[model samples]
Target: MKNQKAVLVILLSNVFIAFLGIGLIIPVMPSFMNIMHLSGATMGYLVAMFAVAQLVMSPFAGRWVDRFGRKKIIILGLFLFGVSELIFGLGESVPVLYLSRILGGFSAAFIMPGVTAYVADITSLKDRPKAMGYVSAAISTGFIIGPGIGGFIGEYGVRLPFFFAAGIAFAACILSAFILKEPLSKEKLAELANNQAQSNFFYDLKKSLRPLYFIAFLIVFVLAFGLSAYETVFSLFSDHKFGFTPKDIAGIITISSIFGVIFQLFLFGKLIDLLGEKKLIQLCLIVGAVSAFLSAVISGYFAVLAVTCFVFLAFDLLRPALTTFLSKAAGEEQGFVAGMNSTYTSLGNIVGPAIGGILFDVNIHYPYLFSGVVIIVGLLITVIWKEKQFSQSLAK
Candidate 1:
């Protein structure tokens, strides 16, 4: 038990540092565009490129995690993450930025699934939700801290945050290399290897494509799609619409992340127990859709802030609830399932920003409006889903 707790802390800390690097660049994106003389579509592509790399790499990364062990992959990913951030910080050309983003995506593909699967390996089924909550809170807390710190540093220079994030990621890499231990035992690894020898990747993937798993993937895609669209154009929108600076954008994201952290830490586990994952997911989807739509039309900074807080809160609750649902259903394929989860998320990130960027060219509000409508569709799909049907399908 003590060993498990120790592993969890190390995993959580590594994840926090990794995500903080990602978030640190968010507020300063406008500056990046200006410096690079990029268009909206170009910037969108830059953001989407990271997910594109992740989408392509995640399935394979998942298999590797299960085969090789989590600790090695995590350390390698963190080191590469630091390198990517450093490249972005130092690069002067658009091509270099693209290269950096692609590397970042690959790093995320390894890190996200490894961390999630590691958590599942260390935790019991009954305690999984709570453990997942802490992981989610750790991620949210990084975003909470990243933007505030990045915004402050960004005042000096836009590239400064990237350098700072690079240093942090490298520090995490060193810490994880020394402290993080593999969760699986030698006997368990031998068993899994023997099982793998008998079966194959295609066969395992086919088994994992159960109805509930499909629903979980769809939910992740919808959630990521909506959020990415909103986030991709947010700084630009605020700047154009309200004359807000990077500092203002950072402040808003910081506030929203605080709400997300609070929900993930204090309310998410209890809510999962109370309403159940299905019910809570449905509720959050509805709230996310409404809040996103309201954010588009709302006037006043405070009103927008309030609406966005609800959006963040809904998203925060939905992530762990859905992750818990999927992890419970993953059976022995925790790494593969987590990889697929990252794939779906990457797919959403890819499509959302591409479409959102094009729409932002037409009108800034269009992206948010489109996000709300798409989420509404996701809500409808959730409503029509039947758990009994999923269970029967899986039983086969």
Candidate 2:
């Protein structure tokens, strides 16, 4: 295979398995928590721990990717992920599950940024969005398959899903060891090394704390807040509102994943190509806001499922487009820009489930309403930013 195609395959496969590992447990988490007598706050903490570890380790992981190689970092991530899954499957207690989540977070931290950087390294600026769209498709495809299978297995036992995750991770490790390869030119590595040696981490951290960072951070917060609520509590809502079970919820999610993949593969790339990233981002945010609001109002499981599919489609499209936009915004500083974006995303993941859990503690509807409001706010900001950028470009 050509190097670029091979890289794409490897990265796409990496996200597929990684997310499959995560999704394998989704259908069982709430029930398992109930069986273990865990509270909403505890669930929130367990989920947040995973994101927090990713937040802490992402920068270092990105640096390691640049220093050593993408192949090495990805292999390391797979190992951690496999180990975490194996430990979690032992099913001791809530505390053990939390510890496993922390371990998985570090694994995700190592793998995700490295894979993204590898994609950026391989694809030209023009094709990057499309390449990223492919990655999104892979992830959703995994979600479609993983949760569908997991939901059935979870009916028998929750621990079985985690065991499945461990097996997948182990297989992924073997596949990656044989298949993944580095593509960075020697000149690129030397330049990266010299820059890293001369760069001050404090300076970079301070810079990432600026207004742009805040804007991007809030955007991710809005996106993740909506998503986490929908993912974590929507099944419960469907059960209450329409008498759906875990299998039914899994079916809805599987259908949603199909929409997600279709939009990401077919629509997202073309929309970005035609409208450009800034305008496409505005469109996605607006669509997300509308879909999420509608999802909250819908009562029937099928109706809710249909509307929620649109929400996932918009979100899946926007993520890669937004990542490319943020990369361009940073200009010549891909590492810092990517690292900052990943950090903010991790922050959102940390905040998202906790906030959702709190609202779920009140009324499930509260989380959806809050998420819709945030999505609208995010859309407005992106629209304004797009107009400003357009004016600047026209003047130029």
Candidate 3:
């Protein structure tokens, strides 16, 4: 138990750092765009490329996590993540930047599922809500801090933050390779490996489409889609609209994320038990849809900040609630479900950014307005989403 807890702590740190690396790019995006002389359409493609790569890698990553063991996969993810950041920092051409995003996407595929499955392997179903709450909190904390630091670092040089992120991630990768032990024993690992050894990719996708899990997965996709659409050009939007600098963009995101962390750390687990994942997800979608629309029309800095807060908070809570629901229902197939989760998320991310980016170039507010409509669709779907198996599967 002690060992598992310790391992969970390290896993939490890994997630935090990975997300921090992601957030670090946010504040520097406008500068990077200017530096590269890129258009909004190109930026959209760059962001979409990440999801495109992740969508391709998720099935293989999931199977590998189940087969090769979590420790090995995460170490590889960390190393790749470092290299991706390095390339992004140094690259002068658009194609080179695309390559970096693709590599980053692959690293994310490895890390997210491996870490999620490892947690599931160690925690009881009853304890999973608390466990996932902590994991979600770490992710939120990174969102809170990373941009703030990145904005500050960008004042020095836009590329400096990426290099800094790369160095830290490489160090983390080295530490993980040496210290992180595989939680699953060899026999368990072998069983997991064989379970996926000969499985066809299309068959696995078909399996995930079972009525039991399909609607929940759809909601996951919509959640990612709406949020990514809203966020892909958030810094650019703020810069164009209010003449906000990187620091200003970072401040709003960082402050709003702190609220999310507070909720995740203190309120999330209780809310899961109180509202159940279904009601909470519904409530959050409503908030997200409304706030997303308001974001398009908001007139002032504080107003944008306020609306952004609600948007971020809704998403922050929504993901964990949905994850808790799915974890309860996944039974012995945690790795498979985790992969599917990532796959769905990547799918949403892929389409959202491509459209959102084009819309951003056409009009600054179009993406946010589009995001509201997309989330409204997700909210409406919840009315018909039904899952009877989840109630009986877990006592909690």
Candidates by lDDT, descending order:
3, 1, 2
Better of 1 and 3 by TM-score: 3
Candidate 3: TM-score?
Answer: 0.97
lDDT of 1 by residue, 11-46 (tens): 999989988887888789888788888888887898
Candidate 3, residue 343: how far the Cα is off, in Å: 0.7
- The candidate 2 region of ten consecutive residues with least summed lDDT is 387-396
Best lDDT among the predictions, by candidate number? 3
**Which candidate would rank higher by lDDT, 2 or 3?**
3
Please provide, for model 3 over 209-237, each residue's C-alpha lDDT reduced to its tens digit, 9 standing for 90 to 100.
98667888999999989899899989989
Whole-model lDDT values for every prediction: 0.86, 0.76, 0.89
Report the C-alpha displacement of residue 210, candidate 2, in angstroms: 6.0
Q: List the residue pairs that clash in candidate 3.
A: none
**Cα TM-score per model:** 0.95, 0.91, 0.97
